[model samples]
Target: MDRTRTRTRYFTPSEVAAHNTTSDLWVSFLGKVFDLSPLVACFQGDPLLLPITECAGSDISSWFDPRTRDIRRFVDPQTNCIRYYTPRGRFIHTPPSGPRSDWDNDVGEPWWRNLQYQVGLLSEKTRWIRIVNTLTSQEQLQEVCSEETMEEILQRYLCYNSHARSYTWKFDGAILDMSATLMENGVPDDDQELDQLGLDRDTFIPAVLLHFNDDLTEG
Candidate 1:
């Protein structure tokens, strides 16, 4: 038997979920995988690392969405300036005329520039699932089976609804662990249709439930 390990060309959402830690941080944004472990190490103890650390081991796709309301909070409408919260509890506001204002103007590119961290695409076993917010009764049908991970789904869900402050998910009455891979917990990894996951076209898996959280920072 060959002792050499084969590097995976694709990663399932569950697979990505397993690396959510400073020592093994990995996140996917815009279908690209990023191993942020090295970056995490460099930013250790830094406040700048708060956002990334909070999202380690998850899909950051929602974070890059330009339409996301979260960005509006940091922007000064009158000046079109962007306020960046620093690790030292400082605020760095960049005016529209600033060189780095391009980042605020176009959020996706900065995150896309991190492609050097690409690992692989979403695994073939991935499946899309419908997630519902138990509090507001809002629903988002997500392709969990595709390249997107649970983290990504949740992020997008939150971004779409302004009333939703925070959320936590559960499957089969048990809280869906963000750090745990769905594949390991019995989610089928195949090219099957929605029915294969025990769901109908309009009917979703009742196992997963999104619960609102008071802590808005919890991702």
Candidate 2:
């Protein structure tokens, strides 16, 4: 385990997709998500950036070579030489088909190689949960990365209930361990199982009832 990645944030595909746009672009490749909005702003009107814009808020793993972890390359039959196989046309960081004297060689690291642009890891799995406030009778359905713990899930619920921490979280009448993940709390994600059984996973989102603790300590 890479201890450096112990607290890595995880995002669902839809969450990434929501950032689609030239002003707020996000894309994932090789399981890592990148915010390319800055790149878009840098190359604002460049036509070569179309391929990236076309795939904003989506995964572009196919654009890279698995082993190389770089743009896919192939022998260009016309040139009889290795070349970046950008059928969508060469985008940012891609060298010209043939070198030109004007091509700036000091562009620094490519966007993919620049770790500063890396936002988070794309979630391998996501699950939906229904959070109900026992005091207010308000319910909010939330989709969260399965990698998130109950404590993190509470943060998501905060958008619906501001004083979320004032509530005692429970499932099936048992208090939950805020530090534990859903599975650690014995919550099973059966989306695939439901699909295999011809049932809609959306129809069976498990509910976590929040019982308000009359802790006047919270303002």
Candidate 3:
């Protein structure tokens, strides 16, 4: 574990209480489970932020790549709706109603319309953008931590904002893995306590354990 990397800043209890982040979004667990800090900081965005440019003159199909395998969609912030495009150059204005039970689940136009209705209640400025690369197979990290390496992960402490929110935290992956093995022997995380109390002990203990383990492994 890299001590320097794990030292990334986190939100304090006061900070967390003050934040009004979206209900659907979640912070990356100290870079443990998910890392979205990178995307949040520097994703090629502004496509969704812009109010749906006059829909009449808008060529929505131009925003999508039909060759991509996954369901390519973006939120129309103006309408507060998520939009998808088809290979035939058509726009889908709705999303699937329930959880996706199958990998190949296909949503019809009716579902798309209903999705639009739901998104309309969300913030008008924030939207999810769909990235596409149809030709070569590429691994775009869906879960990001920082804009660094893919391995040797560390978790992030995210700050939430309610009015402008998306499906998840918007960040890139970092170079540290919180679960990596530590090099030190006989040192347990419980031995150390935070500078403050009242935080979740279970979560804090595991965090300490993981950090200590990484420190040992690196040494």
What tens digits encode model 1's per-residue C-alpha lDDT throughout 133-153? 677667676545433435544
34-138, model 3: which lDDT tens digit per residue? Answer: 122222233224343122212321123344345552346776676756666443433223334334554234544432122221211111111111111112222
User: Per-residue lDDT for 154 in model 1?
Assistant: 53
lDDT computed for candidate 3: 0.28
Give me the candidate number with maximum TM-score: 2
Please give the distance, in angstroms, between residue 168's alpha carbon in candidate 3 and its true position after superposition: 36
Q: Judged by TM-score relative to the true structure, which candidate is superior, 2 or 3?
A: 2
Kindly provide the TM-score of model 3 when superposed on the true structure, using C-alpha atoms: 0.15
Q: How close is candidate 1 to the true structure, as a TM-score?
A: 0.42
**Top lDDT prediction, candidate number:** 2
RMSD to true structure for each model, in Å: 17.0, 3.7, 19.8
TM-score of each: 0.42, 0.90, 0.15
lDDT of 2 by residue, 1-219 (tens): 322236778889998999999999999999899999999999999987899999999999999998989999988788888888898888888888887996887889999989989999998889999998888888898999888888888877787788999999888777888877788888779998999999988888998888878732322
**What's the candidate order when arranged by decreasing TM-score?**
2, 1, 3
The alpha-carbon deviation from the true structure for residue 93 of candidate 1, after best TM-score superposition, in angstroms, is 13
- The positional error of residue 114 in candidate 1, measured at the CA in angstroms, is 3.1
